[model samples]
Target chain A: MNTVDFLNSREDLLSPGISACQGCMAELSLRVILKVLGEKTVLVVPPGCMAGAAVGGWNKSLGTKIPAAMPQLGNSASMLAGIKAAYDLVDPDVHCLAYAGDGGTADIGLQALSAAAERRDNIIYVCNDNEAYMNTGFQKSGTTPHGARTSTTPVGSVGRGKVNFKKDVPMMMAMQNTAYVATLTPAYMNDFVEKVQKAATIKDGLVYLHVLNPCPTGWGTKPENSIAYARAAVQSRYFLLYEYRNYEFTVSAPTKNIREPKDVTEFLQKQKRFAHLDEQDYEEVRRVVNSRWENLKKLAGL
Target chain B: MENEYRVVYGDSGLYVLDTASWRTFRPVIDETKCVNCGTCLLYCPVCAVKKVDGRIQIDLSYCKGCGICRTECPKQAIMWVKEEE
Candidate 1:
């Protein structure tokens, strides 16, 4: 694709009358995704940040002419399955997509999500994970990593923040062996869109993608550094990006060594959520990040 | 809660995904030009695109707001349509 071609389509995907923050990664994600999906697509959103962003009382966030529907807080997967089934009944050529957040995916709606994937539901599941539940407040969720403070995980001598590590969701989704499973970032738009396109073509099975969206208000970072912090997290190996299709792993980012790992200070210091972390705790956090990166590299056979 | 608004230079109410935005950096696919060849599908990094009933489709949740398919399509089927007016 030429630069002009890329430049031309951006105008139609994401319109301006939405409530997303200035540098909201989720907003950017919706635009890129809808542009390719086109107007003939159907979107199903659950009660998460996506729902709050996309469908408001007055202004529907999506810019595309594609029709969208909203399900309950934890029923997007089932809703997509129903929508696909109904569309099939009519024999119409349309795509059904379900978008949710980590809370909806890994916690409240886990059962429905697994059932849909196991049944080979003909839909795309996109989890716009900002690591915490930012819509109602910065409450922590399953995707929140250890040591990252949140509204649910306050900082004190008891601990820095979340007590548990982030869940290995992609691996779990890959376990379904449905068809396509990927973990991507807004930083890599080509890879991200390409994957979305591929998911659209796959046969009767579930296509699952977990996107790491950095939050300015929740993460206590500046709006300008939202993308920068996200890219750094991936490049630094703190949050690895990769794709797994039919059990084969392809690591998206390649880093030399995570030692010292670009100083977690930049990432940690920016967000008030992590303001409690001291220098001594930095070593533990670094160790965790390195270990996760090494494990992912091994999985990718890199 | 409330819809957010940004003043735009154009008369049309459309505000397309500005490719220049730092938060996003990819091309958008114009459905009018897409031919459902599925070539862009095979190479996509996230598998965001798919074919439902022989028609190419896109999944936004995993899309990362990238524009790879917009450039890769041979038919020039996918063009970037900006926001209304």
Candidate 2:
């Protein structure tokens, strides 16, 4: 099969009228998912960056030729379930996909999500976690990690940004014992696409895809450096690639250890998220990162 | 199915789970509590739980029972029971 063509198909789904900022990781992820899903799928999205990126005001859609439903933020999962039920009753061939941001998936919309996943709804649910609520002017969301700055978490007089760690969402979803669950990053296209395509073909319950999308505008990094930051996050073991199936958890990709825990300064220096961090603050962040990495290794049984 | 697979994204390898090797999401179906509302069937993505031979029986092979069936079932006839190793 021609893989290049498979990747090329996404160009059509990505139209020019959307409001995605330059180098927006959320837009890149939308393109990736659309390319793999193609015309045979229906996308269900709730309000967030994706809603703005996919469909602008006045009943206009970005460029997706396929069918779409933009419901309230919390209803994407339930709507997807309803759509799948309708399709099964009639066509049974179309793919029903629910795409939501971290705030919608991990925080606000999690209840409906739990209901959908628990029912083993035949839908591909993708959580494009850009860390914080970038669309709402960089507010802290449940997915935002400790030490990151947001309007709500404002880099304070105390010199610390956020004080809480990001939720371990992928593992939490996998704990549901569903057939497929994976953590991915745009830097790893081949891996991400493979996971998405596999999920598309399965006629089972929910398939959870957690994509770590970096936000240049919110994080105070260069627009061009978003993908680079994404790669760094994975390499630093801040985010590891893995999949869980049939009660076995497998690290799908090996995170070659980067020596010395990569001075949080490497990441902090680029993003405004840690602009307030000083020597003492940077060291504390480093310690937390190291502890998390070691615990991750233990979880993967490596 | 092909024995050979291509590497996608960051790595390559397939971990297969065969029938005997499969892990069931073992469910407890309390027929006494069932109202026959069909909420479980409506929400079940795999259709693993059904009115087989006139009563609710779970097809353990396909039922991961993520518990939408249990949660949505108004009568709460279904409960996710863990499978023993």
Candidate 3:
């Protein structure tokens, strides 16, 4: 569909007053996702930004108007699997979506998620990676990049932010050989919508979407710059947008042929989370980012 | 006396909850300047802008007033106005 047609066709499932911070891309992603999944979808959200964004404060109902179940931390995948199993008895066409943050998917929920993938559960699992434990107050998580500062990884004397690299959850899911695995960002709205649509069509096994949702509050950036940062991430090759299906890997259209790539340093400098990085730290981050780009190019047979 | 709760299943009809009270700033479109290009409609996170009868309408009920539509409008047709308390 064309841009206008697609925009007009959206049946916005999310209500306002969600308490999501201004320009919170997790909320944006959830809205777009519901538009694609439509009314026959059941959402299973754990305790994270996605849940907080949907049902916060005095709002007891999940504003999406869809049947939603809130599971404990790290239990979303299994809960969604159970929900999908029960739905199979009545209506097998209902989409079961498990949405979680990086902390829920990469750290606390990995075991259950892996088990679900192993069982070939018919569900679509979405990991909205904001790169930290943002909802609970900007603590470092497994996906937090090295040299980025967070509450847990404060840049103080004898402390140099987070020392570990971001976890590659998409690669791990692809290793499981699930029906579909892809990375997306809300900045690329068309691409993001298409991927979610494609994932919904897969009936045999699990479909995983690892979306990079830039958090203005946690990332220490202006809310207006949220989409700019997302675009910068792709242009700098810090986050490669690609899909893995049928044992084949292909980079998405936007990041596939990036001529005159922007420097990763420019992208890092925009966020206050990386303000503490010195010259040597910048070099280290650049080296790591370049190597990741090279590795992805090799995989894509460039 | 017995305490009882109704267990409703998938029957919560779409609730059109008005969220204008939560808005600190609301988007006001300049109709004369607008070309109905639909650029603002595409970038609006909440999908608050709707096209009805070939004109764009912003539904304040679902609009969190994020100002993304104001920021993304190519024609600069959307203006952010402070909501009166």
- Taken over the whole model, the C-alpha lDDT of each candidate is 0.68, 0.70, 0.83
- Which pairs of residues collide in candidate 3? none
lDDT of 3: 0.83
DockQ, every prediction? 0.06, 0.01, 0.39
Give residue A121's error in model 2 in angstroms.
0.6
Q: For residues A1-302, what per-residue lDDT tens digits would candidate 2 score against the true structure?
A: 33433453343354433455545667667766776887688877788887765432223323355566687888788989999998998887788887799999989889888888899988888999989888889889999987888888876566466788888788888888876888888766667778888888778788888999887778887654666687777776678788877777777653544444455566667677776667887677677777866765676687
What TM-score does chain B alone reach in each candidate, compared with the true chain B?
0.55, 0.62, 0.77
Interface Cα RMSD, each model: 11.1, 19.6, 3.5
Pick the winner on lDDT between candidates 1 and 3. Answer: 3
Encode model 1's per-residue lDDT on A31-132: one tens digit a residue. 667666766678777877766754312242343345566688788899889989899888656778777888889888888989999998888888888988
State model 1's lDDT: 0.68
User: What is the total number of backbone clashes in candidate 3?
Assistant: 0
Candidate 1 segments whose C-alpha is farther than 4 A from its true place: A2-4, A54-64, A157-159, A253-263, B1-85
Compute the DockQ of candidate 1.
Answer: 0.06
Query: Residue A12, candidate 1: how far off, in angstroms?
Result: 2.5
